[model samples]
Target: MNSFFARRYVITGIFITLAFVLLARLFYIQIIDDRYMLFAKNNVVRTQIQYPARGVILDRNGKLLVDNQPVYDVMVTPKAVKPFDTVEFCKLLDIDKPTFDKYFDKAEKYSPSQRSIFQGQLDSTINAKLGERIAEFPGFELVLRSVRSYPDSIAGQFLGYIGQANDATIAKSNGYYHPGDYVGISGVEKSYETELRGQRGVQNILVDSRGREKGRFANGMYDTAAVAGERLKSSLDSRIQKLGEQLMRNKVGSIVAIEPSTGEILCFVSSPTYNPNLMVGREHGNNYMDLLRSPNNPLLVRPIQARYPPGSSFKPLSALIALQEGVITPQTTYNCPGYYVAGNRRVPCFHNERHGTVNLASAVAESCNGYFDMVFERLINRTGPKNTDTSFTSWRTNVAKFGLGAKLDLDLPGETGGLLPKASLYDKWYGRGGWRSSTVISLGIGQGELEATPLQLANIEATIANHGFFYKPHLIKAIGEKQVVKAEFTQKNYVGIEPQYFEPVIDGMQAVVDRGTAVGSRIPGIVMCGKTGTAQIRHQDNSVFVAFAPRDNPKIAIAVVVEGGGQGARWAAPIASFIVEKYLRDSITRRPSGIEPGYFMNASVLPQPAKPKPAPVKAKPDSTAKPAQAALTAGKHKKKKQPVVYAAAILKGDDDE
Candidate 1:
């Protein structure tokens, strides 16, 4: 009986030990760690994201240039969706059965862990359909997004375009952004991308087993609110932009207008420009590809990129340089017999007329190549080894003050450095600075390799207009959060030209409008001062005009270029004058009725030589011969671009809202 009791006690002890071990193991698994619970939670709970609204762009007058329009994107979680009607969903979305099947298969293949858009560019039609069918489709919801829209139909080139972020961009800015993000590719949008692209927020939601979205995770504790992008108020004026566009409709170059005192760009236009709104959203891909393939490439901002020789207009800068260096005085006279002869090359002045002996002012007004050549030659001497040690170095310093040979560092993008070959540059080419005026005489009249963009040319005129100082060229007047727009640009550059030199040049420029090649652009009742330039290019000529209004206390400074459009006075003058009149005096005074000026609209000024020619008769049924009466009777011409729609309807006024 004693042995049996001992064995029974030992068995009880063993049972107690096993029970304690089992309880300890249960506590370790259930209370000591949370790995399994996290895994379990993840399996049942669903998380989603909602994109925030992007900021808007407005003109200086508080008119909308770009705004966000509500759009929807259809996203699907393959695992979360259940009992989805296949046929009705496909028909209502207007997608084929295969497309629907493909998305479904892709989502399933990627699994519920993947976040991707299944359908994009949902219109109001699709939004309506999805609203009604919301009860039928589970786990598929419309993700609200915004598409960029342009309310105004002007200044498209200056505003630029936007597109999805690429691989390289993602790698660089990945900390702040993600895949499928939109970015400004050009213009002000590109230059101010950081201020324009707002911060993104995220949220993690808890869902029931049935995939119904429950209230926020931890009572809105785990959500990050989005920061909307800043509002940008540009320097562009809607009225000026529209008028400039209309004035440049038949041209093929660019026009840049700025307030002389502030360097604030009022109108920036590149001819053959396209609608910027066409370059956003689902339609962007196709439209962009087409524009890229187009011959004109209307997207390129030519005002800052298209470089051309300054022609006779550059003479004014050269004259000022010479005068400041004391190489020539305002009373200096030169004989002009239509051309300047440099041994073998002959640079011809306009009209082949003889001005006999002329002073500096009349020389500029007449655009005499001979007078400018003498001045440029003298300027080279001042910059070379002399008692004063006048060298190309000092000349370059003076030219730089005029805003040449470098980027303007404007708020706008795509600004190019107008080429100004220095003495060192020539020294590198001519073997150690021994080359003389004979080496680069044409530079006197702004010829040779010297090239400048229209914007730079305009800035030069602005400097001339201001006597010495010019406001830095800028496009954005204000930029910051939507609540408060900050002034982002405030600076000035002063050219070192003496005030005494400015008066003579101003007189010469005014003489140009009074009686010169640019006389046609002279605005009545306005003291207009301007310079006309006709640069020689391969196969044709490019017309250029630069001006600042109301000679004293000027307001608007303008630069105009017409490519393959011969004679500055013929093509560029009228456009510049119209812009000046519209800005200073309210509206244009001269309306050329029954007389349409020759513009870049034509492939050729005339299909044949500008001679009286006979008309052709209608072709009869002739099988063996292709004949125009066996004579060249081609005098007919056709315009390249036509006004298919009315101006008011096509270029609607700004901010309809």
Candidate 2:
């Protein structure tokens, strides 16, 4: 009896302990951990995203370049959808039944209970028309969103465009963005995406069985308010930008103009550009495909992406390097016999004018090939260890001080550092000590593997304009009300050249506009310093020019490249002159006569006029026309007729080499 009692007591103790542990777990789950309870409640709760308004972009003078317009996205919850009139719904949404079915399947695949976009980016008129009857449909809801709208359609490449985020973008967004979120794709928009894309908010609400909102969940305790994006004040001058586009209408090149003192880009123009509006709306994919298929390659941002040999425009920088190295002085002279001869090789000058005993200033003014060649040879030979790698390394280092062969780290995307040949490359090619100044003399003329983008060339001119220092070039002058210019852009970047060395080069450049090769492009009242370059290409020469205006206190520095445009004086110089005149004088005094507004095949390669399109016929208004239809018709009529524009193509293609 005693043993049986002991065994029974042990069994009772085990049962009691198990019961107590179960009760404790229940208490803990009920009081301490409410996650399961919340999950159960979430079945009836709905969460909606509140997208904030993107910032407006304004030009320097507060002209609205880019703004936002209210757009609507049709959202659907597949589970809430009931058997309804499919044909009627398709007719109301202006979509075919197949599209409706396809979208429904897609939404169901995403999530049957959660809301997904059915059709996005509906315009105001369409959204209004659909909103009146949308309540009759059980599963569909209209969510308001903002899309980019351009007040003035200019600076398509520089301003960039926004589109829906790709899978990669969403994966990297750290839960900030979902599949359908929009993101900036290029240019200023891409650079300042974080500042321009405001913080998102969320709204939680209680919903009934049919997906109807009952009230804010928990009296809106978990709701977060959306914050609007910060405004951007760009450095671009809209008028100047427009003028540049007009001037480059028929060309295949780029123009980069910077304010010399501030390093603010006034205008960035890439030819063969499209309307920024084309990149907006639901049809962006198709329009982008068309642009991509075009032969002109309008998508390429030529200012910083396309590398061209600096050509004669490089002479001023070469002169500065020579002066800084003590290999040449303002009084140094060399003779030009219409050609530069080194051993068996000869480089010919296009000019017939004999520049005999030309000094540094005269050499620049006349663009004396022999003088620069001699200066380069002296620079290489005068180094401590003569005719050695040290000589070439010293020469390259001085050149790099001018911002050559290195990225300038501008805010824009896809900026090329350009090519700067190293001494090692030469040593590898011709073996060390076997090659000397004579073998690399072509570099003196800016022809042998010395390439630079228009932005770098413009910065070089800006450095010269500032008398040996420059601020890094930038696009955004201010962000929000703080005027947040980057410290890098504010600090002066010196070229390691003495300030005194620039005067002779500046004087020669001034003479270039006054009485030299670019004399025809000279402005009447403004004192301009300029250099003309004709970079050799396979089909034809690439015309290039770099200039700074009002020689005393320069306001603007500009670089222009015109592919296959013959001499720099012919196309690039005049284009730069026009840009300068417009900026300083606020009006263009001269327009090049050869250019006219018309359509043409390969406008950049060759000049030709195209027949204009016929005007639209005016239609008589009908009395039964709806208000929306009438408004749309009026809008069509009110579209300011754009002037005839030009299209470009690559001339018989040649390698950039």
Report lDDT per candidate.
Answer: 0.71, 0.79
The candidate that wins on lDDT is: 2
Ten-residue region with minimum lDDT total, candidate 2: 648-657
Q: Cα deviation of 164 in candidate 1 (Å)?
A: 2.2
Query: Model 1: what TM-score?
Result: 0.80
lDDT of 2 by residue, 330-353 (tens): 998887776666534454555334
Q: List the residue pairs that clash in candidate 2.
A: none
Angstrom error at residue 180, model 1: 2.9
Candidate 1's residue-wise lDDT over 130-149, tens digit each?
Answer: 87887688767777777678
Once fitted onto the true fold, the runs of candidate 2 whose alpha carbons sit more than 4 angstroms away are 1-15, 31-34, 97-113, 351-353, 384-388, 590-657
Q: lDDT for model 2, on a 0 to 1 scale? A: 0.79
